[model samples]
Target: MPRSPLALAALATVAVPGLDAYDVRRPAQPGTDYDVAVVIDAHRRRWVVRAPAGAAAGAALEAEVEVLDALAEHTASGALPFAVPQPVGFAHLPEGGRAAVHAEIPGTPLRVDALQPGPGLAADLGRALAALHELPTSLVENAGLPVYEATEYRQRRQAEVDEAARTGKVPPALLRRWEELLEDVAMWRFRPTVVHGDLTAERVLVADGRVSGILGWGDTVVADPADDLSWLLVAASPEAADSVMEAYQLRRTELTDPHLQRRALLAGELALARWLLYGVRSGNTEVVEDAVAMLEDLDEHTRSLDAESSATYA
Candidate 1:
């Protein structure tokens, strides 16, 4: 359904807060079921309002609060090197509602489409990620943070695939291919580390050819680092992938386990599957097609890896 004219007009004409929403054209696509308001008040204060379903609102708000607390702890300890968005205030909605208000960062989001290749971009990303991972995990956990688990990942993937199949939006071949890919259970046992959990193009912000910030910690977790690496696999050009791996390896030198590689690759596949499902619900063809293409590439790669593993065993 088309957006209501009044809503469209309000979105177009209303001044955006903190940073210019003027440049923020309507997301070429609409977002999920949440209501988003980027508003700036008379004092030139800018903030973001994320209003999600009240049913999951409490849990979601707690999650956001945990992220903010993590950032704050990092900031206080001088460990958070990048410019992460900070929460200004949180308010409880009447009648069991949930919303978080955040102080908007001053720069435009570093979109993946505009990413330029350079010698250090990968290293920059790797180093920033290292900074994130290097922080004391114990401290964060003491504050009662959540970690994304393999069961959750599998269940989420299954839900999306099921939804697409039920709607007849997913091709049978694609569904079959994904099912075949799921037999590689060894890919799920990599070492656990801090992960942003939802590392996608939208969550990355770049400026001056360097990674200025990483956003969307709402789904952040102390899970396998491979979960975040999946985004790099998706975003980096094939040629650039080697460079990213090199940089990541340079900072994290102990990743010799084949299981780690498998986990990371599987995580990439899971991300693709989830996006495909999301595209089905949102009716976005670009997202759906790109996700499908990525999944195919990943399947081919995984097959090659399996062959290599078998040969090594022999």
Candidate 2:
């Protein structure tokens, strides 16, 4: 069960000594593993309080504090183009975890449904992501985060595909397509860099039509740049997605893969497998069924596209 805003507020004071939280409410970003609240101190300063949902989440939250500190140092030396949560204090939870307080960042969460196609917020989002990828890998490495080479990354994806197949729920066609994509050596060729690893619409905060802040850093990894771009595909406007890519490509300090977009699409599609696996492992029938339904829909959708392509070529 989730903690109430008031409950989290109480914990906030304990985390940050001298914190006088007079008002506490919900925050804009969703918390999958943390019970979160926005606390307003006597000085009208906004602070965020998060209590971990489980032992794994608690561990990740603790690690994230270090990762943010490392990124914060880099931001001080060079521009990162956006704000990240700054941890100010921490307190251990009675539930065998921990809670922390952070200075709140400005801006509302980005909604992909409401994006402008031309170079505006979309371009800002692009540049923001490019800046993150451009950061030195030493920051994440020094902090003891996972770093992977191109071949290792490919092998990892292959292992996931194998696991999903074992569930006996994934469409055979989708499985075959993923396996073929994983086996394509040319598709796997790209420079590994620091990635946010779990980017989504809610993680990006926007204001004045520009990306102002990013939230969530626990899943940070040094891997394919395409993993970062996968969420941009959720943009309602194809032109907006294109704008993001144009800005990202322009701002990047190194050469990008020729098949980056294809790989990003592939990455997005593979998320269904992860969902299915999570559901099966947890014995959540509703989630497992939901994933299966989506898989079937995707299978039919892709097959129709293939049919149209074959006819077009013939």
Give the number of the best model, judged by TM-score: 2
lDDT, candidate 2, 1-314, per-residue tens: 88889899999999899999989999755467889999999999999998998999998997898899988876677679888998998878887878989998888889898888887998988899999999988878988889999999999989988999999999999889899999899999999999999998888899888888899999998998899888788445898899999999999989766988998988888888989989999999999999999999989989999999999999
Model 2, 218: alpha-carbon shift in Å? 0.6
- Compute each candidate's TM-score over C-alphas: 0.66, 0.95
lDDT tens digits, residue span 1-314, model 1: 33342333243233222333332223322356445556554555655655554456457666767767767767667575567776665545454654565665555554554444456676677667766765655644754666556656555556666665675544566567666555456655445566676677666677766776666766666677776776666666765666666566666635554655455665665666668778877889998888777766765766787789999999
lDDT for every model?
A: 0.60, 0.89
For model 2 the TM-score comes to: 0.95
Residue 37 lDDT (model 1): 57
Error of 2 at 225 (Å): 1.3
Q: What is the lDDT of candidate 1?
A: 0.60
- Steric clash pairs (candidate 2): none
